[model samples]
Target chain A: MSLIEAPRTPTRGRRTGGINWEKWGWIYMRASGVVLVVLIFGHLLVNMFLGEGVKAIDFAFVGGKLSDPFWQVWDGLMLWLALIHGANGMRTIVNDYATNPKVRTVLLAGIAVSTIILIALGTLVITTFDPCPAGADPALLASFCEAL
Target chain B: MPEKSASNLVAEPQSPPKIRSPKRPAGTLYRGNEGMWSWVLHRITGVSIYFFLLVHILDTALVRVSPDAYNIVIDSYKTPLMGLAEIGLVAAIGFHAINGLRIILIDFWAFGAKHQRTLFWVVIGIWLVLLAGFIPRQLMHVFGG
Candidate 1:
């Protein structure tokens, strides 16, 4: 075993009943990774490179996309997948590096707590956002919202 | 010839005690079940998402600064290149979300692990279906206008 290896690095990780969570976790990483590549790239291409691209983004712009149920579902899925994927990856990192049991626990805890909070906030923003509020200063509102 | 002491000859090779187990012959690792494949994809997607997240949030935050500032940047997205890029993002999201569901099922559902391989295929099937639904509409939006 390497100096930092968990003293007993099971050739295979522990099991629960007949299940092996570690194996599953590993599998989850690869599967998610492959999918994320396409999702993330497509998202970037559309948002930053498509019509009007980055130059067209604004309160009106985002509001327009969010207004559509299609974009809503798309953004929501992206949020959940990215957050969980990131959190799981961090957990794996913590497991690999934080040899001290207490340190590992704390880091893992932080990852979980932070990830959950971000997911909640992001989802809420995507779902509940309004491009123009009734009482907001007209100056701040996008001109497009005037049509609504 | 030098005097070969028993201790000198015997101790040197084994002193480090390199516990070498027989390594698996190459492709055996890759030939494993769905779990292994999933793990690999998850790690890769996890890393890719991290990079995308950084850029996405930075741009999204621009909205707080000023509408004009944000719109200027987003306006660039209308190009043909970006439209093509959108398709790629749909494919990625479709696969990741479906695969993620499989994982969630394995964790929470009683039958998840037992039928994990079947579930794996189901994930792919759903992903393709979603893509089929999503692509044409997205293409029209991107290219038609």
Candidate 2:
């Protein structure tokens, strides 16, 4: 076995005139890396810098942010983009290291399943979150929610 | 046996396992081991940050479950143990971000590709300064009484 595996499959193999997934995957890493920096840093700054800093963070802080659709979309985008980016990176690593074809298939399947499930759950939470539910105890709700 | 050897010769024509010094194109410079180290670190930081992202998303999503539920998870992070972990998270993110920028520059800028070693050092220098600068402030926030 060589230190680096032969470039196989889509990167260097016979093609039947279809979309080049490997090329797109390469492009996706660079593109998503750029965006994740903004989404991630903005997230850190807001959570730990603005307002009263990390000390102010609690259910209310998160609840207030989720109440706004702007933050919801921002959070949702961060969720989807970063998850896919991470999953794709894992897939590349797995492909590079996994020597056995059957083992590789199983590993890739596991990644796909976990990534799909997390993305679904994350998207659902971000979009459907009701910071102040009708049935929740008034005492537990954010003060702003009490007005409603 | 003779037929098999003939087929092996044909296959070797394409796969060419022998060491062959291919011509360097008109004008290009080698980036050396420093370039290789940068590639290795980039991948390592990427994987580390991705792992952090997984845990982070799960914790924040707990907010939607219930206030008590979320508080249970988040409040635990205030412990000294988790505070120490925060330092590691910040370092991973800082390295990944700067190295990512280096990669982007190398990809787009013709000069960056030529001097990627220099760019890598620049990335490291910024990362150290940021990490050094962040430690005092963040440690205070994390472990401050």
Candidate 3:
């Protein structure tokens, strides 16, 4: 008779019913990563490549884009997707390195809170941003804002 | 069959049990090779991009404060030093993005693991091409063409 070898590591018995969040998180990393690659590259191309690059960025340049519904939606998506992706990646890192339970939980909570706050703030900025605010210097405004 | 006595067993000179050198060299796949280096680079770039995202969000949030507030903050991004930093940022992003796709392929595609080394090289190739196109234009924009 052959002697049976024990498992090298401890593992849980298969259980049913609850949602597998860790699995989903893994999937999210890959799925969101694919989308982010395209979204961020497009963002960089438009914002950094087309004309003056970083030198061209300013309040007017940003306001011009935010005022456009297309860009608003694009930036909104990018913000939400990228923030969560980053937070989740950080969570994985914390789990790997922060051995203390208290420290790990605190770090994970920090990531979650910051991600939520940034997503909300970014979304608000995109949706509520006004290119032509009254009483502001017209020099800093987008060219179209002058007509408005 | 008679069992060998302990004294006879102890007295017999036994050749060292043939320790078969492993079929494959140790420390190549997961330790020192393309797979390992790619993974290390991926972690480094991922952490860097994450921290940058946090700062970027805060900076962009200044837009809500006022136009002047936002412009004042953003003006710093246009400096020559920042322009050089942007190159590093883009390089990190390019590697992360390309290597990320390679990771996905390794996870989902059957041939991916078999070709992971190849995929890593491919990632570097694509990343170089991207930087090639980006650096010159960025230099022109920053230094004034």
Task: Compute DockQ for each candidate against the true complex.
Answer: 0.15, 0.35, 0.70
Once superposed on the true structure, which residue ranges of model 3 sit more than 4 Å away at CA?
A1-16, B1-25
Q: With candidate 3 superimposed using the best TM-score fit, by how many Å does residue B94's alpha carbon deviate from the native?
A: 0.4
Clash total of candidate 3:
0
Tell me each candidate's i-RMS in Å: 6.2, 1.8, 0.9
User: Which candidate number would show the highest DockQ if scored against the true structure?
Assistant: 3
Tens digits of lDDT, candidate 1, A21-135: 7788777765665566566657656765476554455577677777789888877777777668677877887888898989988999988887777777777677666767676
What 10-residue stretch in candidate 1 chain B is worst by lDDT?
Answer: B24-33
Q: Against the hidden true structure, what lDDT does model 3 obtain?
A: 0.89
RMSD of 2: 10.7
Model 2: lDDT equals: 0.81
TM-score of chain A of each: 0.80, 0.85, 0.89
TM-scores vs. true structure, each candidate: 0.53, 0.81, 0.88
Worst 10 residues of 3 chain A by lDDT: A5-14
TM-score of 3: 0.88
- Alpha carbon lDDT of residue B122, candidate 1? 90
Model 1 TM-score (2 dp)? 0.53
Compared with the true structure, what per-residue lDDT tens digits does model 2 show for residues B91-142?
A: 8888888888888898889998998889889998998987786666666776
What tens digits encode model 3's per-residue C-alpha lDDT throughout A23-110?
Answer: 9999999999999999999999998999888888898989889888898888888898888998898898898899798998899989
Model 2, A1-148: lDDT tens digits are 6787666436445887899898998899889889989998888778764554565677877888888889998899889889899999899999889989899999999989988988988988888888887777666667899888
Candidate 3 residue lDDT tens string, B12-66: 9788888889878787557989999998999999999999998998898887778
Candidates ranked, most accurate by lDDT first = 3, 2, 1
